[model samples]
Target: MNIVVIGAGLTGANAVEELRNQGYAGDITLIGAEPHLPYERPPLSKGLLLGTAEPGSVFAHDHDWYADHQVDLRLGSPVTELDLGRRRVGVTGTQIAYDRLLLATGASPRRLPLAEPSNPDVVYLRTLDDALRLRARLTGHILIIGAGWIGLEVAAAARQADATVTVVEAGSLPLLGVLGPELAPLFVGLHREHGVDLRLSTTVDSLTGTQVDLSDGTRIHADTVLVGIGAKPEDQLAAQAGLATDNGVLVDARLRTSDPHVCAAGDVANHDHPRLRRLRVEHWDNAIQQGKHAARTMLGDDTPYVRQPYFFTDQYDLGMEYVGHVGHAGYDEVVIRGDADTRVLTAFWIRDNEVRAGMHLNDWDAIDPIRSLVEQGTTDLDALRDPEAALPVPSG
Candidate 1:
């Protein structure tokens, strides 16, 4: 059997590795748009931007690893055409046939009309190459539009670099939709404490030259302007191939697409999660675990990808790990544990005594229990918010 993976990001790499681990000796090919080998993206926003991690450290496998595994690794050229009916993909003017194809194409940065790519001063971060370009321009006054994860992380990196950073967000708090109102203020205070000129409920009216005019009629000068609103899934090839797509390439519980031979994972897959409904998760853990899951599904494993959604962030002194799923106004109660002043706390998003999701700030050890809490609702209502309470909370 011939297997081809479209993408060389963390998801693709992990999928290929999983195939090999599963003893699939059939021919395999991994295609990537970037020249660099498959690497993790978390560092692009965290340690790499902060200059604390080396460039080579983000890669999942070295060049020799692919060769040792006898995997045909294709880099730099993107697959432009996908003909699922004929089971062939056009790559660099060449057609490659595959018995099974995995679309781990990932996602692209959400572009803005005001921030033109032709403008050298304006930038966006998504890949290793993008991060490198943005890193070089981290100095001078940095004006970032959007208070999302990328924006806040870049703000933290710029402030640490002694660059005057001003962040403008249309929302009241950073990650308001994800974190919700109760725990959202903590992040607002964090960035403000770090000397970031964060303007909430504001947006960029215009990005002309080095000056950014705000909707509130305030203007800020910038040497480097980054637009980090969010990203849209790169499912054009899947869509063009006539595969089902909405927000991303739609996949079932086992990560199988509408067409049986074609499958998708990573940020490109809008999975029909059994427990959490239909959603797309763009995170390190999801990429790693779901990539493996998709590979197994391709190998005839009917096991559903039942893992809960998880993600983490490190900004200034605040480090957070969030588990499970909830929306902007999805939860009924926000229960918090530990000390708020010391910045060590665990917060739960609860709906009728059921823990929909949970997060911990600067409390690394709280993740497992948070997972357990999401899995098992607390027996005693008071135990949900008690750090001293034993884990799993013993459901009635």
Candidate 2:
């Protein structure tokens, strides 16, 4: 079979590797727009930007791994068009036919509308090159325009590099949309404790030279500006191919797109998750898990993708791992096991007396127990609130 994967990110790389591992003797072609080999993106904002991680350490596989595995690794070859009828993908002056195709195109960082379109000093942390560029400019006053995960992480990295960092967020608290107002303060405190200047409920009105005009009638000068508002999924290829797309390429429980021969994974896939319903997750774990699942499904595995969503972040002394899914409505009751002020706590979101989601801040050991509670639908709020409470065993 001619299997063509239209991305060389974590998900695309994993999909091809999983195919080979599963003993698929097919012609696999992995195409990436970037010149570099497939690499993990999470480190770009944290370790790489901080200069703590080596450049090659973030790669999914070494350069020679593809040749040794008999997989065609095409770098800097972006698919320009997709001919669904002929099952061919048009690249730069060439086309490749495929019996099966997986779209793991991932996402791109959102740019500020009012900011200068092409400023050498303005950086966006999405790729390895972006990280390297931002790391080089970390010696001056760095202003981040957004208090999301990327912005806060870059803020942490910048502070560690001895750069005066400032984070501006239109929301009242950092990660307010994701963690909600109750838990958002924890992250806000984490950055503040690490000497990051946070300007909350603030919006950038205009960018004049290196100075940023704020909606609050204040102007701040920054040597460098990093925009980390959010990201939009890369689903244009799928959409142009007549695939169903809303927020991303709409896929079924098995990651199958509108066309049976086509499937999608990673950030580009708006999958019909069993637990989260129709959702698109942009996380490292999701990319790996969904990639493997997509490969298995392509190989005739009928198993559904039902794994709970998981994500993590590291900032200064704080490390957080979150499990399960809670929509924008927020959780009913947030139960804390340890002291939040102490910077070591496990917060569980309870809905209808059942654990819906949980976050472990500076307490990594609680992830397993928290996952158990979420999976078993544990309802004992008193036990959940106790740090010493044993995780309930699942009853068959």
Candidate 3:
């Protein structure tokens, strides 16, 4: 089989690796737009950005892995045309035919119109190169827009570097849209307690050079301005190929596109989930699992992709892992399992008297049981709520 995977990020690399491991000996070609080998992006905002991790530690595979596995690794070659009809992809002057194709094309950070492209002081973090450049500039006063995950993480890194950090978020809480009102306060207090001058419920009116004017008529000067206002899916190729795209390339429970021969994974796949509504996840776990799922589907596996959404973040002294999705339907109540006063706890988002989602902060022991509750569903809300009660709650 002549299989071609567009994208050399975490998804594509893992997908190709899975194919080899599954004992499918075929002509596999992995295409990448970036010159570098497939690498992980999480460290860009964490260890790499904080200068604690080695530069070469983020790559997904070694240089010889592709050759040893007989996978044609094409770097710096982007697919200019995705011709699903012809079952061929156009890369520069050549067209590569494929029996099966996987679009692991990931997402890019949102661009700010106010931030000039020529200005080095204004920046956005998405790639490894971007992280390296921003790490060296985490000095003096750092002004960040959007109190999203990326924004909050950079703020934490800046504070650790002894640089004054001010994060301006338009929402009432730091992660209002994601965590909602029930749990957003935890993050707001986390950043504020660690010396981040959080400007919540406010927007930037204008960006003039290094000075920013706020909607509240406050003016602030900044040494560097970092915009972490979330990211959008890179689904232009799928759209141009006449595939369904809403927020991202729409895929079914099997990760298959409108065309059966084509599949999309990672950040670009707007999955029609079995448990949840149509959603797209941009986390590291989703990318890895979905990539493997997409590859298996190409091999004629009928199993559905039903893994709940998962993501983790490390900011200040807090480390949190979240499972499941509440969606726009919202939650009925939030149950806590530790000292709410202190910086340690396990929280569960309950809906319709069922566990829809759960998260833990600085508590690793509760993760396995939390995952069980989110996936298997729990009947005992009383025992689940009790911090003293053992999890997976003793079902009679």
The CA lDDT at 334 in model 3 is 86
**Residue-wise C-alpha lDDT for candidate 2, range 12-123, written one tens digit per residue:** 9899999999999989999999999999999998888888898989999998899999889999998999999999999999999999999999999888887777777777
Give all TM-scores, in the order shown. 0.97, 0.97, 0.98
Error of 3 at 316 (Å): 2.0
Candidate 3: where are CA atoms >4 Å away?
Answer: 393-396
User: Candidate 1 on 1-396: residue-level lDDT in tens?
Assistant: 999999999999999999999999999999999999999999998899888987899999999999999999999989989999999989999999999999999999889888766899888899887888888888999999899989999999889989999999999888889888877888888888889888999988888887889999998889999999899999988988899999999999999999999889999999998878799999999999999999999999999897889999998878999999885338888888888777898888888677889889998998987888786754466756566875545443
C-alpha RMSD of each candidate structure in angstroms: 1.6, 1.3, 1.3
Q: Which ten residues in a row have the lowest lDDT in candidate 3?
A: 387-396
Cα lDDT computed for each candidate against the true fold: 0.90, 0.89, 0.91
lDDT of 3 by residue, 1-396 (tens): 899999999999999999998889999999999988999998999999899997699999999999999999999998999888899999999999999999999999998888878987899998888999999999999999999999999999999999999999998998876677877998888888999999988999899888999998999999999998889999999999999999999999999999989999999999999988699999999999999999999999989899999999999778999999988998888888887668688888889998998989899887877888888766689888787887754333
What lDDT is reached at residue 138 by model 3? 91
